[model samples]
Target: MDSPVQIPFKSFIQLDSKSATAIYLQIVFEFIKAIQLGFLPEGTKLPGSRILCRLLGVNRNTLIKAFDDLESQGFIKISASKGTFILSSQKQVVKKEGIRSLPNDLPVAVDFDFKKSNILDNPVEGSDLSLQFNDGLPDARLVHTDVLARLYVSKLKRNRNNGVWEQLQTQAHLNFKAQFCNYLNLTRGLKIAPLNLLTTTNHEISLFLVLKLLINAGDKVVVASPGYYFSNMSILDSGAQIISVTIDEEGINVINLREICKAHQIKVLYLTSVNLYPTTISLSAKRRIEILELAREYRFIIIEDDYDFEFHFDNNTVLPLAAIDTYKNVVYIGSFAKSLPAGFSYGFVSAPPDFIAELEKHQRILASGVDVIKEQVLTEWIEEGEVHRLAKKNKKIYKERRDYFVELLHLKLEGSIKFQVPNQGLAVWIEWLPSFSLIKFQKKCLDNGLFLPKTTLYQNKNLIATRLGFGSLNEKEMENAVAILQKSIAEVLIEIR
Candidate 1:
């Protein structure tokens, strides 16, 4: 072939050192864009990696990585002696930037009211929140992965006798279901069967599955006001109208819930009764019984999302609603996400076996069922008492962190914010004083490299409160975070004054 064509490279792209994107991936994207825009035509030989690196002011290794990625993705081809060439297969007409294509019959600019759906209407961009004050996430750095590795390797070796496909086909997961049943019975005071249990990837997925089975179009679903937004959004996605019931320190206002039931025939009631999301308040025992009775009377399914039950600070955690549920009206869900490291999160559902069967059937359509290796390893953890050991260890550490965070927060923020130290979970509900603005405080915190989840910034009438989680952060991190938070508060309060 003729000598490769050399093209000007400086006009195309520039790299930002502060950007989260890797330099190699940036190089790849720009090259893809260049090829698409016909600036580098098909069969065009790009400059050598060394030349390209010098031109772009990037490392030769980075340029090579970009070239390798491009070739792997079929964007470019490489030869033993020749440099990289843009593949002819990539030739296509590129849409002009800042322009729209409209049919001749339509108006150049359509004028119509486009209302955003509930899920799409969220003003909070998830990517902006870097330092998440998650409701109750475990410090994964503290998890004992060495024990898990041993168990996983042992199980892997044993599982080699049978193929992975065979393992998937058999009743292997039932062992975990059985193990979980026994564990729950011992810890939470519930008598359940393996058939009553269904494993899911996460609490959100389990909640969505349960809603799909219970909700119908036009049906009324009740959720606590300022509840888990994800669950509420899922209900809206299911074509059901949501009835928001207010929650106080005693949890979902049962009296108000009774009134809601009187007016609407509720098909489902979603709640994080163990430790209510964003507030970290447990549902009172009186309300628990009353709500179960209401569930029976109103003929609705109660979804109790006991999401971080493993990290209860107070030794006296109230039994989960499902543990005491007698009317078969409650579906309980929990996650080991907070008890162990991520990627090992084991979310599970315990409902009447018949309902679980339906949920499993729906699950099968979406997935090939659970990952047997993970299930096997987790089952070993439960059976060998490792799960209990980890939870017990984390609970003490979390309590200490929670207390330290509270002390630091009080020292720094004293009169500017008022809070109640939560009894059970990993976070505290702190109400901002009327003199300061929440949005402004959050912006200041973000500027200082601390991200507060928007869910934590709750507003009701004139009151503004946020749940500051302590479980995920260490004592040192908590101190730094609180110091930054105090500084942010001072700046915001000054502006307000």
Candidate 2:
């Protein structure tokens, strides 16, 4: 006899036949509510299609069609190996419409309260901090939060008195992105127009929206294996399947991408283009063209997150795929949180202008609009040349930090760890010996009052690593963190040895 299955149903929909709303939409709204309440977690697996259809008493097509609708909206991820899982984090941050794929059967209702926070307020103890590898998060204290405060005040005042701010009044907000674009063109060689831009609340949102627009239900989406895990989360959560490609010193395996596409009908390809997560290796120029040509030939959309593109050590910048996209298939995304002080919250997405308009609709549909104050204040900062000035200064500082951190890291870890050298981007990706788990390594780091963005944040659990942001630490602090990490690793490695 087979053992009984366990499926979470606490947040499952209760359909009323006489109700005016459609049943599928009713299901969608209920799931969205569950997500908002944390009853459904990001990547929560649903039952198989036949099981879901039988349980819901709905036809397979209704479930399949509904899932396609939801996948397009960025709500859920469905894969052969993983079945179906919710895409959104229940934060109510983005629009999750009435869409979901039905898996075939039911199990016991899941106990949902078990899955909420991303960070442990007090993480598990004995985390490693001695080895010095970590991420670069801008100090919040350095940002113009006071101006942001005033911008919010002004927006509230204006909204209370005049109702919603008209789109006309907000046109000035484009200047924020416009100024950034000019800087990118002049300094980084990535030419972009204001018309091709859409701003989001953060870097992740840009990825979320891009995945939604390009991927359909059951479609194959390619990503670098051991790449950014959140991108994996976002892609899988979006109701599509994942195709993990190998990455090397140069970047994505272009030949592997072609093979995957050949074997599967890949709908989208996502890459960092500049410096990729975990590895920090920029895809080579020859490979970049190969990807573009393949995208055009295969009709797959290439999503270039270009995240942290502004932060490169070399005077020569790697141009975005969108900049060279004569076929208009490249969707280029940039983040303010990486370059500017994070917590200030601003980033922009640029694509074909028509797509920008469509994607902006998704952005508005997600947050109504970014915090009006963030946009305006950020606009002011950009126009004043402050954004570029700080960026230029920090770029050099971050480069120094990367160099020094690595120098000390080499001293401590020696042959125990490895990393890739990229021409651009923020985080230096380090791969630990297979003996180390980032989830375990990160826990060790947090115990020391030394918090680094865990490797899994960008890719999957198997990628045991962390992004050591030189931007987050100064010369003295850098040395201290490195020494601390070395001590942590030496102790751990000794036990294993």
Candidate 3:
């Protein structure tokens, strides 16, 4: 057996007086780490308490406490005469030649094999540039932060006064569910009880739960050609094979979809019907009726992701398919974050009561339950009409931004790009007419201090387009970004020539 003095205890057993962890616990942890890493193998005898205390420059009492803890935890055996011996069963084997020094950090790679998922890789990109564009995200600055802060604090105080915080796990916050259901009924034309709705932290989780419940491995799922990338990832990650259908001005090609239905058994058809992602076009009323009829005939679920339903600027806005889904085949997914500020968003699913009950089971496994305090805050926000008030206020601001952005695009790149002024959402889909590379344009934009995320760029053999979000950019920022975009296009065209 190697003597404790042969092992470099002073090197591996590091301690910090300023650390918040207790000194004795720190010593105990260091010893456990050393043993596990083979620095101190099983049967290695440790120095006496007094000797170690002197060597490590630690207090005698602290060293003794560490030894006591190690022995209690079965990592060491303390004897009256022989000395403390390492007793850890998990200790790695060490050579008898000498003690080798290793890095203090833990191993980075695991020794065992496990499954890896490339389908779940994140497609979202982030940037720290002062000027940037996204795929139609809400403006964080326009959110009512002060009002939300006050409401949250007041609710917390009231909960504390009534001793409700202690019972948070049990409190269901049914009032919020009732108010949410009522809000949907009035705004989106859905008649649902509190039990028919299920709330989640965000749209992705809500859709994930619904897909996991309905889809199985090798199941066939249909999505639009240039669909929402994140939702498509989720569908593929659930082990379902994705089938793409073309989308046009009217929305998804229902005629083509019916042909596909005739050929294969599709388990689900996921779409952003209200304002189609990237395109910002609504599924026409005629197409909505036809799609619903096909769903009834073929017995497939329609996941209508009406993510930005409240941000529609058009006067002739159409209601969601769920509003007129008499066959109960439409599973509607929506988010409240588009109306609120950055962190205060919540997502929900509207389905049958029985389906919701089944979803709750999966939700409990994923997240124990929704935050009771947040639910209460939203309940008060909805009941006092603050939610609607904010939605109305922000809609006016976003519409103005959209108009200004469209004007700038026309003024700067009239012949170089072609686009439609989207009437429903915060983004405008601009198709670039030039044959220059979109990737080269993105690189040039970055060099000029403007970041255009890869997710916002859509390119194929037939099309070169980008979804430029104006909601988050004010007039001055929009002007600057557009100038940079125009300059980058000119530079790319020069390179191509």
Candidates ranked, most accurate by lDDT first:
3, 1, 2
Which number leads on TM-score? 3
Candidate 1 clashes: the total is 0
C-alpha RMSD by candidate, in order: 15.7, 13.0, 18.3
C-alpha local distance difference test of each model: 0.74, 0.64, 0.81
lDDT of 2 by residue, 174-230 (tens): 666677677666654556778867777788788878877877779888888666645
TM-score against truth, every candidate: 0.74, 0.67, 0.77
Best by the lDDT measure: 3
lDDT score, candidate 1: 0.74
Model 1 RMSD, rounded to 1 decimal: 15.7
lDDT of 3 by residue, 417-479 (tens): 998888788899999998755656776787787888757877665678888988889999999
Winner by TM-score between candidate 3 and candidate 1: 3
What is the Cα-based TM-score of model 1? 0.74
